[model samples]
Every structure is written in structure tokens, then in C-alpha cells.
Target: MSYENKILQMKKLLKKNNTQHVIEKEPILKPDVPNYAGIWQDAGLKMIENDFGVVFLLEKHYPLDYKHGAIYLRELYDAFGKWQQTQNAHPISLTDANNLIFYDTETTGLKGVGTHIFLNGLLEESEDGFTLKQYVLADPSNEVAFLFESKFWQGRKTIITYNGKSFDWPQLQTRWTLNKKDLPPLKEHDHLDLFHGSKRIWKNDIARMKLTQVEEEKLGFTRLDDVPGYLAPIIYLDAVKSGQPDALLKVLQHNEWDLLSLLTLYVQATNLLCEGIAEESATTYTNIGKWYADLREIDRSEELLQQVTNQYTREEAVNAYYHLGFQQKKQQNYIEARKSFQQALPYLQGRQQIIALIELAKIFEHRDKNYEFALEMTKQALKLVTESSLWTKESKTLRLADIQKRKNRLERKK
Candidate 1:
């Protein structure tokens, strides 16, 4: 069936199933009228028209006292500005508060041409604090109108969202293409996907990295009486079909909260990044140290890893010490690197222990020129592999053979 025909069929099914509970008991609005000013006004929303078509919008201003989590909204905005400056990639020009847009969308389903974006929520910093503007597609046919009317993609320098790069933005692009609408110049904006940053920082602490989980656990924001996003399509279909504003209101509320949470999460994550990992958990410090190391921030990485080694248990400190040793070795601090490697050996077990042994053996042989010590370390590693059940006999035999070669070479040097 044609896409338009499919949409018409879905609308028919929705209207046929609309009960009084789903539809408002008031007089029904005629479908022939393209304008929904009266209906939207009655529902506490404003209908606005652009060159594209008529779309419904609701704008709300939140005061400085509005608390998303532990931090007030104003404080969050300040932190976000600070965080943006610190980011090496996609450095945001936060000189104008209006340049940034925190965006989130509620869609009919995960993906594809059939799915439609029902709502788009955006939070921008205004002179009177923070302003949240939501564009609602009262009818699926108004999707283009809503997207065009919002103008979020045009003026913004930075667009922040949770998993939007993978899901939300792509879905919108697909819809725009299917509708043959001109794609907005979103390429001009720096898109920051909070999902990647959140996962990098909090994956060890929070197992499930969903936006809701991040809100509750990390930001300390709890949502109340909100509809799940998956059920949004059903509720939206019912509302559109029945011409009722109730379910759509709930969807708008949910979308608004999502945008607010995105702001909170972005602020929290950026604050954490800027403040350093001094107060975080041992594992967090170690993980963050590794992340910095990957980014080649050698001094900062060493400092954090050293904190883990100083305060955490041997088991907790093992990997940190290994990383610290590697960093030291890169800087040619052989003596300090040796101490770190030795500190790690006692806590390491299984494959890690074997790896540590090889590392120490290399350090002794190559750096210290201590052939006897290198041979001893290699012999010990071979003995452990022979006795332990960690490796299969064939694997152990191969390791033994490799170790034997190292031992023979070292002994000959001695």
C-alpha cells in the first residue's frame, strides 16, 4: 500500500476504536479544518503557523530555584558552560546562551519510514533563566510543520542529546527524506552525544546506561507518573484518532522531563569531567585514569592512577599499578616503573599474573641489564603455568617453550 494510504488506514482504525474514555466528551473538532488553534488553546497549548503548516507549541520558563537533582537549574547551566570550554573536541562557543540546544524526541517506534516523530523537546538558556520549548505534531501529517517551526537545527551551535546520534537524529532524517522535506543544516552544529560520554565515565558504576537510569542514579532526578516511551505511539495514535488532548498532554510532559533530564545529565557529566576524579570511587579513578591515558594526558593519568594505588586494596590497585608502570616506562622512569610492576605482581592472578611476570622479566632484562633476575622471573612464570589449571596443557606447553627461550638467552648473557 502507498504510504499515504497506510497513514489513512491507521487513522481510520484509530477513529473506529476511539471510545469516550479516549476522546474528550466535548464537541468534536471537524477534521477538515487544518488549523487547531481552538483545540490547542483549550488544551493549554498554542497553535502557531509557519510557511510549512500549523504546529502546536508550549513554552515554559523555569526559575533558578528549579532543581533537577542536587543542583539548581542555574548552577547546571553554569557548569555546562564550563564543561563546554574544557571539551577538546567540538568546542562549543557558549558566549551566547542561545547557541546551545538540549534536544530530545519521542517517536512512534524505534526506526524506519513508518515511524513518525510525535514530539520534539528543546531546552535553551534564556535571559530569564532556562526556557523549555516543545513542538508537538498534533497530527502525523504536521511532522514537517513541527520540525520546520521549531528551527532548533538552524541557529544552534551545539545540540546535546542522550543517544540521539544513533537513534533520534537518524530517525528524523529518515522521516524528512520519506516526506521529501528539505533537510535542515544540522551539519553546521556540533552534536554531542551524551551517551558516549556517560558510558565512558559511569559504565563501571552504573551497569544499565539508559537515560532514565542515568537520571535516577547519577543526577538523583526521579520521574513521577510518566508514560514509558515505548507506549507513546499507542497513546499518541489514540489521542490523534479520538481528538482528545489528555494522552498527548502526558506524552508532552514525558518529553519535557526527558529534555530537562538531558540538561541535568550533561551538566553532571561535564562537571565530573572538569573537576577531576579526586572524590570518586577507586575503580572510577582507575577507569578515568585509563581514559585520560588513552587521550594522552600522561601527567593527569599518572596522578589519578597513583591515587588508586595509594588508597585502594591490592586487588583494586593491581590494574592501576600496571597502568602506572606502563606510563612510567613510557617516560623512561625505569626504577619507578619497576617498583610499580612489583607492587602489581602480588595482587595479579590467572592471565594477568602471567602478563605481569612477562612485563617484569622484560624490564629486568632490557632496562636493568639484570640477566639473572630476568631468568628467575621467567622460570617462576613457567613453573606457575605448569602447575595451574588456568591454561590448557598445549597452551601451557607453548608458554613454557617461549619462557625457556628467554631463560636460555638470559642465562647465556649472565
Candidate 2:
């Protein structure tokens, strides 16, 4: 308030004397950002605008004969009869390929509040063929328009995805919460998340059940010059700041590749459910057999399990024998169950051996009513508890007491 105040007062007095009045300076407004869309016109990103805001749309059409991998694009439409035989009906009605949309998403992060979807890629079957459409969020602020425009599930019945049930769709739900007022009412559609199907089919066979790995192994095609998915968030965030859409263009291609793979993967996964077990691997036979058993399709389960046990011996498919025996037990086919469990005995040890012996004992006691065999099995289990060092001393003592009781019951029955 000392010398500086005096200088400011003199300056104000001189300025007022020089000018009759001081005009009010207008407030500065930020100019609209240009060239984010323009830079990608060569890359086929079309700026589509509506009431919500602007979204960058990139789309392509694959002809019917165009093959993504080993599968032609037409297989998605032509595989209807086989699709009808799949478990994808009822809950989702996957038989209707006409009402299908193959969907995938790339996000800023894995999960939680700050994570947002940057790309939503969808492929739909049309009369002409397959059309892949990718909607991009040019900036985080325009998420409303991005989601609004990319609600490709609006009229579709079932949306197929790799992991949309857990990750992608939940991210969309978070975005909808942020922009609910501007968005149209959400519609109900059955989700046929094929990630589960792939796991069921190839989890034991493949080391990692990642989509890219599956595409290379099962779909018979490897992605060339494709941007890694983990780098998507980084590439996109940099593009947002630098306004360089060139690097982001590769990410868009990665997304397109994902959508196309989803279509072919669906065809492959559905085929597994429909095909005969005779042509499948022992691993695939066991897998699909277990799947059928879980669905309570007893006949199909028994048939597939029987095939494995017939073709492969106990050492080759010990686990298969156990599954077959259990499935046989469920059907009250104890005669066949006894044979399978006996085959499993050679592969057993420790607690597993003890448990299998107890199961065999029960089959003999309850089904065969052979108390002598039951007592012998109980003695074997008792001997392990006392002799085997696989378990702790205290655990052995506890299990020893239980086996003693079982042996006493069997002796009394004998």
C-alpha cells in the first residue's frame, strides 16, 4: 500500500485525463478445437454430430466371401441350424444371428471410478454381409455423445462379447450413470459373453485364454502390425493431449480386428456345442462332457465320458475316469461306476486315494452289498492315515480316528 499504491493512483489519474471513459474489456472465451477429426479423415473417421455432441465414427463392410480367419464372413449367417443346437438358446436366443451384434471395448483403465471407455467397437450381420462400426470418444468430455451414438444394442436381441459381461458392460453402466439425463432409456438385451464359452472349450488346452492367443491357435490367423491392447489407453491419452490422431488410428484397427475375431469365434464356439463327441479330442470331449453334465444333460454326458474311457486307458485319462465314474454314479449306474473308479485307483495317493477308496467302499456296500470288500477298503484307508507322512501328525491322528470309526461300522456290517 506504500509506493506501489501511489504510482497506481497517478497512472489512473493520467489515464482518466487522457480518455473520457474506459471501455469494459470483453471476457475471453476458449475457441473450439479443430483438426482432431480432420487429421483422421484419411483414416476414415467421419465426424457424426447430433443433439448430444460429436463422435468419431469409423466403419467398414466385409463381403460375404471375405474370410477373417479360417471362417468366411458368411458362416455367421449360414450356421443357423447348428446355432439352433447350441446352449445359447432360451436365456439369450443365440440362434437368431439376424439380431446379433459382436461387441468389444477399449478403456482408459481396467476398472473403478476413473476408468472410462474410449472405444466401443460393434459388428453386426446385415443382408449385404458383415459391417464393423467403431465409435470413438475424441475426448473424455464427449462420453455422452459417444455412448449415445454407439448404443448399437438398441434394437438387437443378443450382443456377443469376449468379456463384456464383467468389464465392458459395467464400464458402460458407469458412463450411463454420468450421462443418464441426455441418454435414451436403456433397453434389455441378452448378453452371450463368449469368453466363458472359450474358457470351457480351450482353457485346459491353451495356456492363456486371451482373445489374441485364441485367434492364432483356434481361428487360424495371427494379427499383423496390430497394436497391443495394453498400450491402447496410453496411445489414446497421448492423442487426446497432442491432437495427433495418427497413432490412435492403429488402436482403431486393433478394435476392428477384435470385433471381426468375435464373429468368427462365435461361429467356432457354437460349433463345439453342436458337433459329435466322436470327432473331438479327449480333452475337448472331457470339457464338453463336463459342460453337458453341469447342464444336467445326463445322456450326452455319459456318452462323451464313455467314449474317453473306451479310447484311453486309466494312465492316459485318470481325471476323465473320475469324472465318468461320478457321472455314472449320478445316473445310479453303480455297476459302471465301480469299473471306472477301480481304473482310477492306480493314479490315486494320499487323501485322494483315501477318498477314492471310500467311494469304492460305498459302491460295494450300498450298491453291491459286499461288506467284505467295504471292510477291506476301510482298512486300506485306515492304514494310510497311520502310515502316510503326506499329512501333518495331528491331521493324521484326526483322520485316523475317522477311518477307525468307518472301519468299525464296516466290520459290524460284515
**Model 2 misses residue 193 by how many Å?**
1.2
With candidate 2 superimposed using the best TM-score fit, by how many Å does residue 45's alpha carbon deviate from the native? 1.1
Please provide TM-scores, in order, for all candidate models, with all chains considered together.
Answer: 0.80, 0.83
Q: lDDT of model 2 at residue 218? A: 86
lDDT of model 2 at position 238: 92
lDDT, residue 334, candidate 2: 94
Roughly what TM-score does model 2 have, to 2 decimal places? 0.83
Candidate 1 residue spans exceeding 4 A from truth: 1-40, 80-98, 180-187, 276-278, 349-351, 376-404, 411-414
> What lDDT does the true structure give each of the candidates?
0.77, 0.79
Q: Would you list the clashing residue pairs of candidate 1?
A: none
Model 1, span 250-320: residue lDDT tens: 98998888888887776676566566555566666777777778888777678878878888887777888
Per-residue lDDT, model 1, residue 339, is 91
Each model's total of backbone clashes: 0, 0
